[model samples]
Target chain A: MPDLGLSVLLKGKNMARLLGGLWVALRISLIAVAISLPLGILLGVLMAGKNRVVKAILRVYLEFIRIMPQMVLLFLGFFGTTRAFGWNISAELAAIIVFTLWGTAEMSDLVRGAIISIPRHQYESSQALGLNKRQTYFYIILPQAARRLIPLSINLITRMIKTTSLVLMIGVVEVLKVAQQIIEANRMTSPNAAFGLYLTVFVLYFLACWPISLLARYLEKKWR
Target chain B: MAVKILAETLLSIRHIAKRFGDNTVLDDLSLDVHKGEVIVVVGPSGCGKSTLLRCINALEPIQAGEILLDGEPIKPDGKNITELRQKVGMVFQSYDLFPHLSVLDNIVLAPRKVQKRAKAEAEAEALTLLERVGLKDKAASYPRELSGGQKQRVAIVRALCMHPEMLLFDEVTAALDPEMVREVLDVILKLATQGRTMLIVTHEMQFARAIADRVIFLDGGNILENTPPEIFFTNPQTERARQFLNMFEFAAVKHHAPAED
Candidate 1:
């Protein structure tokens, strides 16, 4: 018989533990996204530089981050680089560092793409209006380009949240990792509870990403 | 309008040539525009009419020539770009109204930032311009909310708010609806009578003929005719000028003469 009373299965410590895991996941995601924003904007601006030498260097860096899988990057940061550098960092901090780097690179390229996609005439028109370079950017270019960037940026933030689950492989106790621990420990003592704990983790991710996705879509429609 | 102080030659260019990969947009172009002179540049597309206007403001760097505004070359060494931009205002073919900004903010930004006008003063000035352009009711509307003519009107006022020594219009009404075209042209004509020095890049022969103090016909990246509008439009010397004017007339009317401006 199928278990129709799955909601009833979660009670007391089991429920509390599931909630705690979700909070941990949320915290990691929030911190990771926050740390990446300014760095991403700076790098993105650099990638849009007109100078060929500077642009080439930025393209290489941006592409490397984009092409590599997040898992390999996590391993390189936590194990390979940490070993190479002779640093004994904790897995939680390492996971944060890796995710921050990955998220920042992705976010910056999005910003660069949005900004550069602005028509060439917009810059010329602003300049013709007698706005020197800096004034043109602050008054004309940036404000216009920013509208295109916001929805894309929010989408990136949600992706960052979803990708935080991969950090569980680094031994960090994010929501999914915590859920795994609960499942293993309580496996023999109520095997069905293991299934309930994983389902709760899945629901938590859905909750976090749902509003963000909705926000991105809403902004897209509204701005259009 | 007569030259009020003769404006001491507001802008002058000498032997300027521009090329992109051996494709010259302007060749040996030279002209001197006085303050308050309404000079209309008319030509076939790709004859470098817009490029010349852009060069006066340093929007496009010219190769192998020099441009002087008030007898000074605009160079990278000049530090007061905001000040210079405050002195020159340009309206574009696309209107280039900031889509995110309301019709009012589009006018107020350059003044508040570049000209250092107080927000209250800038808005007051902007409101007056909007009123002049008949867009006072559209102050709060975004660029996307306005019709093409209304957007271009806001653009004209946005340029005016900078208090430019001269205004440049790069085919300002070329992109508008037929009914909308006259409204924008009306604003420019009104500005002309009010003594604004302007360089207009246009193909509208009727508007050019009505208001242009000086009209220059550019062909093959060279000025084929430089004379008063009456001379250039009525008595075109070059065969090329006659051919080009015919095309413009054809676009506006079905059975137009080839020799008419």
Candidate 2:
């Protein structure tokens, strides 16, 4: 049996490096979420509007994003854009841009579904109450839509955090990359360093995501 | 009892035509509702009673028509439609209460937001209205916590909060349980007694007779008879009216008669 002790993680500067890597992942995820949420919600509300042209345009964009793989999108944002446009973009920025695009597409669909699922009578009743279109959306529709949206959006955020591991391919030194580096450095000293470090990484991700999952469940129950 | 134009007309719907695709729901329908009068529109299902109320409140746009409120002709697509809507309150068959908000918030939302009334003033008026409907204690409770009857009552109070010149009720009690129906109808009856101008579409024949100053019997998208409740119920002019009343009479007898051994 290989030595599976957490010595590699406890070694000099490894812990801090891993934490720093996690911070990078978390930062990208948070930035993506912050950027995507409002824009996605706007897109969603507009998608629900009666404008045929706008709906058609949004539908094409939404379908393209949904059908294309996230990895492919990341590659396009990172390598393709730089080569095609001759613009020098950083790895972190590329990750942020790709993730924001993906997240916005996903979240807008969620918002659209939630908004559409609201019964027709709710709109009619608000109109009957003498509320203008703007007032109706802000006061009545959005408040109800938020209940359905909050939990789903939180779930998407956690997924984005996990998916940020893919950024290592694009040369972003996130948690997974840090783990690989640590394992490589300790290969001669500790035979089971890879196992120990990977386990630690797993635990870190679980720790980061468990609370979010629990919160989602709690919101679902509360709203129900 | 002949039709009586007892007071000055508050709403006039002329040449209104509503169509959903190939189906014509209302065909050249015209109606005059007097101030301080309670008009109940009754007919068979698909007879356009509800559609007529919706047209008056501008919930459903008419293809060709002029709706005049207090001598002002209402343009359905005009910029002033929102302002016009403020004067016309509507209660739907489904209570349609905002599920996320408390009962008090539901009642005070329009007054505070649309009407720009002071929050305190809206709350005070809402509390009084709730108390009148015996739902004051339920002010802080969400709509999901309320019974069907309670929800409908809150819906009414929400409309009243706007202090509308005219109120439209479209089968407000149609979705309630049998026992819960009375509580909602009683609220409408109380409003009628207070002399609020109202146009109600209902399937409750007995309640219509009790509260309506005039009853409009619609058939196949046309007004078959428009007369006082006493006359319309006792001596309907058209065969369709007589047939409709016979069905109601049959249902009443069946409902009240003793069960067979």
Candidate 3:
């Protein structure tokens, strides 16, 4: 077979650095997800509410996040905010903040869609049966909405993981950043190392996201 | 069985007007339903029969008017609305059973959660109600597992488990298949015989004539005629009421005759 330059990943300390870089990406994303899940759910419910002002405010917020690019958001969080607010925010903290903001907006929309997808008759029937608002959501609405939410949210988690790659633009030194460093360091020894290093990065991403995709598929089928 | 409608009014609707945007559904409609009275409301489609029931249960907000249950006014966002709703149960055209819950859980949910009743007591009551509706064995079944008629009966049982003073049925049998309609209607007929107070909005004329203590004929967002079922069905005063009855009678005639084929 032709030489595909697959040997660079087997070199000293390079593989370990890549793994550490991946963990950095994962840590930021996992922390963001943990914060987003509950906060997003609350915001979702509020977004679905009848209050004109609250709905309008959340509408503007959701639209703003959707309209702005994630890269610009990261730049704003890391560099622009530091200049404007006169506070020193670390690159990792900035990455976490930016990802959490993006994740929350996406997650809340998912929850809002899930909540509104339920038939209006469900709410009327529950109310007629003397269930208070809180009781109705707990006993009837949430349990059903959760099924729709779980599959969609797993998909969000995967997206969040992949999107964490964007944080390297702000100098967070994540997987893609480490892969570039390795490729540069090995340029003289292995001129074809760029191909293998990039290929390894793709494999690492697939390995990280494939099982989650499988879980989402399994749940969607099982619940459906 | 002949129910004795007591002189004391259990529910009183006073000049209520309900509007959706520019369209008026119920305009200046007033009614008094006494204890143990079976008031069946018959109207052309979109004549506000279901809206009236929803307004009474506080599901729909009235643009104008007052509704009193046990001499206390009922408002959509009233402070004691939850407590008031506990005393007034409403079933819908669609069965609207909680799909995620088993029949037993659906029935006992409100009793346990709102009324703060003991779990054993709620389940026992639910089982008893289910048995009365001929659904004793279906207590563990989810809404999707049961037939439409079975689901509607469970919806009724769910409402009854709350021990509401009055029940509202908004075309509860409308969604069932022809054969399944009887089973659901039979349950309502049994409730009427047992002297349960009810306000029923239905198109089942024969059943309405059989069960209603009084019949209210509605049209154009108003009650055109409020009379006993005997008078209302046989000799409706207005030309509008006559035309409405003729349409049903005409259909009934087609129903009994041999198939054209």
Q: Which of the numbered candidates is closest to the native, going by highest TM-score? A: 2
Q: Model 3 fnat?
A: 0.86
Taking the tens digit of each residue's C-alpha lDDT, what string does model 3 give over B134-211? 899999888889999999999999999999999999999999999999999999999998999999999999999999
After superposition, which runs of candidate 1 have C-alpha atoms over 4 Å from their true positions? A1-12, A211-224, B1-7, B246-261
Scored by DockQ, the top model is 2
Indicate the worst ten consecutive residues by lDDT in candidate 3 chain B.
B252-261
Model 2 interface DockQ: 0.75
- Checking candidate 3 for backbone clashes, the offending pairs are none
Measured with C-alpha atoms, the lDDT of residue A191 in candidate 2 is 72
lDDT of 3 at A184: 93
Error of 1 at A108 (Å): 1.1
Point out the worst 10-residue segment of candidate 2 chain A by lDDT: A1-10
Q: What is the interface RMSD of each candidate, in Å?
A: 2.1, 1.4, 1.5
Q: Which candidate is the best by lDDT?
A: 3
Q: TM-score of each candidate? A: 0.90, 0.94, 0.91
Error of 1 at A23 (Å): 3.0
Candidate 1 chain A lowest-lDDT run of ten: A3-12
The C-alpha local distance difference test score for the whole of candidate 1 amounts to 0.81
